[model samples]
Target: MQNPFSEEQVRQLNEIGKLPPTEQQAKLQAMFSTFNEEQIKFLQNQQKAVQEQGGQCPFCMIVEGKIPSQKIYEDDQVIAVLDINPATRGHTLVMPKKHYALTAQMPDGELAHLFMVVNNLAKHLFETMKAEGTNIFLANGAAAGQRAPHVFVHVIPRYNGDGVNFEWEGKKAEDEELAKIREQILKEGFEIKEEVEEEPEEIIEHEFEMSERIP
Candidate 1:
């Protein structure tokens, strides 16, 4: 795509860019001072628009019907929707109806129930779509590639040559190292009121399975 700015605007921008680092901020302030009230308001509105897009929670809007989505499953606690950007044909995303900013923030009851819904959807996708395999993944934080503020459980159907890859270092640690890690998790003393049933490990390997704040 071509540059959006007009000739004069482009020239002014280039001139501003060429200014010394120490002078750039003052130059920018003076340049904006030339803009009239309407221009100033327009710039402010543009800034706010960017902030809203970056900071606004999208899944919350979808649950509220403010954003249109084709929901495949929904109940009192959680909802599953077709992923707008799919890794494969039958890719889906399951998330809580109640927005939890982080997966760790979700109550144990909600977390257990959410995966049950996820499990059912994955089965339907694998059977109906005849996927060779499947991957259940959660990108927990920004470092893990989480784009939205909302927690999303990605149910991706995998074929033999799907070209999707999650390259891990597969780094190994000592048994003593692993035992110490286990000890810290046990130290936290967090236990659910009732234990939740776990799914078979034969199917998709549920990613993001880890304890908080590695010891």
Candidate 2:
């Protein structure tokens, strides 16, 4: 069976179709910088297998003890585990204990609690694991590379010369275009709260990147 492409992944491939042949090749090469030919093929096969498994949300099973994972943090509201497909060493995933199929579906309180855990965990990953930097990745939909419908925030600890790069091809926008986007974003974006008293979350410190937790 063919791998089920995310909507965003499909859009990216379709955009590549608009490029000149030479440009298309270059863009394609850059987008796949982390994987070699064999790895890419293997990923495709693995993705197909995952898709064929009937769209199960693996993270939910892990939370329920049906799937074993090295959990390093948990609270009444959120849980943290090592990612199966990590971008770098000490990569961790923070998810809400309550199910939210997408980030947009998450309540403000749960969202705040989820990121609070992510922030604290990222700090520990760097200080204890010797990671120099970190990347916090969240996806709302398939276009953002969300494989599972259950929302997860990836906290990837970065070291110097780590091969992971999430850069996209840059493009210039006119001042008019930029101004309109800025206005629209400011108009519709989140309103900052002066005080959001979130519940204190629990943290469990563990010492390894193995057991479906890290790179």
Candidate 3:
């Protein structure tokens, strides 16, 4: 499938992949310096897919022992585990117990709780692993680099000068054009409402039954 995230955007991000640490930080700030409404919505939708799956949550399967993972932390509402393919040392994934493909799919309470877990894990990695800092990331869709259709947050430890990088090049836009984009987003935003009611309750019940059967 064609990536929903633009090649231009990726290229801009990849530029950081080539830069020195100080320069990379500057680029990162500049990249997000002008986020428009559409971009925000796109990212929001990207993260919200988790709840749409009716909390027949994939992360729950891993926690329940139906799926295998290098365990990090496990609790009733969340789980933290090592990424099978990590980008940095002590790389961990934080996900909610309920299945959510994207952040937008998550109920506000669940999203808040998920981030709390992520923050706690990041603190542990920084203190226990003795890292300088961390990168907390969420990929909401395939276009945004999400391989699985589950909502997850990546906590990657950053040292003083580690070469691990994710950078890209971006095209500049005129103020007029940016304004038009913002207007369109606001127009659409009015039409967008939380569709939690659409989620199938049966799926939740089935998932709960499966969870009980697991040893």
Candidate 4:
């Protein structure tokens, strides 16, 4: 199959990939804004092709017993295992038996079950490990620091002087902006109604060029 991206674009994409996962999506979105609709579609196809290339997900391997792990809990729908590289002792990762890139891709029942397992595991850690506190974290996407393509929830047991920091710089929002956000979310059906807008004329102008072949 022919490569869809130009050499320069490929280089830019590589650089974007090098950024922290939390920052990568924003940078990629900025870069994507420069591409035409056809280019965007080509990028989407490229993404689908990459996923179809059958790259093994490590979490899936763990579920299949191909990769050894410290299995703490398991059920028909999900499994819980200790993280090899833990932020704290007794840190566990709870994931669905089926592979999913994001929680949003999972069914509501399955997603709920996954978290219920997490809650129980957190309590277990607190009682068994005598943890002072706990942090239940889910990195939903690359933009949220998700390293693996498979989705999982982290349950990290916390203790005094653990030195683990999850803090971020605080930004103050104006009251008007906060009210607008609250109103948007609190609207009927709990859905935010965004105004539909058309793409820029230039972004719609470029045609899809699969290859630079001259007939």
Candidate topping lDDT: 4
lDDT of 4 at 18: 95
Q: TM-score for model 3?
A: 0.59
Model 1, 12-73: lDDT tens per residue? 86797797633543444556635554544544454346546765457877877788988877
Q: Assess each prediction's global lDDT (C-alpha) against the native.
A: 0.69, 0.70, 0.66, 0.74
Candidate 2 vs candidate 3, lDDT winner = 2
Poorest lDDT segment (10 consecutive residues) of candidate 4:
201-210
How should the candidates be ordered by TM-score, best one leading?
4, 2, 1, 3
Give me candidate 1's TM-score against the actual structure: 0.59
Model 4 scores a TM of 0.64
Q: Write the per-residue lDDT of candidate 2 for residues 32-137, one digit (tens) a residue.
A: 6443445456444554456458654577777776788878787677788988778897788989865555554455677877886788788888878899999999
Count of clashing pairs, candidate 2:
2
Sort by lDDT, best first: what order? 4, 2, 1, 3
Q: What is the number of backbone collisions in each predicted candidate, taken in the order shown?
A: 0, 2, 25, 0
Which has the better TM-score: candidate 1, or candidate 2? 2
* Deviation (Å) of 62 in candidate 3: 1.8
Better of 2 and 4 by lDDT: 4
Error of 1 at 34 (Å): 50
lDDT of 4 by residue, 144-176 (tens): 778886789999999999999999998999999
TM-score of each: 0.59, 0.63, 0.59, 0.64
TM-score comparison, 3 vs 4, better candidate: 4
Runs off by more than 4 Å, candidate 1: 1-55, 179-215
